[model samples]
Target: MLPKHDVCGEPLYTPKIIFKEQGETKYETTDPYVWCRKCKKYVEVEVTQK
Candidate 1:
């Protein structure tokens, strides 16, 4: 099941992951929001970072 937006009650999507290289290590990053087609804006969702 997909998460719902707090304001719009729309289904939230998983944010994309980006990788970056710093020195000799790889780092990960992602957006804190999900895309909403109806709202046309990113909606914040619960996420756990590792």
Candidate 2:
């Protein structure tokens, strides 16, 4: 199920995976998430590995 906005109680949209480079190592890291149109932000929905 999709996550709901805390303030607006609206459903969030699942987009592309978000990734971040850690240190000098080229490892990409991120968590599973959803995008809130109402809040205009990405909200984490599940834990993920680096």
What TM-score goes with each of the models? 0.73, 0.41
Q: After superposition, how far is residue 22 of candidate 2 from its true place, in Å?
A: 20
Stretches of candidate 2 off by over 4 Å are 15-31, 47-50
How many collisions between residues are there in candidate 1? 0
Candidate 2 local Cα displacement, residue 11, angstroms: 0.4
Model 2 TM: 0.41
Tell me the spans in candidate 1 whose CA falls farther than 4 Å from its real position: none
lDDT of 2 by residue, 1-50 (tens): 65566778888664455556677656444446777778787776654333
Weakest 10 consecutive residues of candidate 2 by summed lDDT: 24-33
- The candidate maximizing TM-score is 1
Residue 20 deviation, candidate 2, in Å? 16
Tens digit of lDDT per residue, candidate 1, span 1-50? 77788777888888888889999999988877789977998877778764
- Quote the lDDT for 38 in model 1: 76
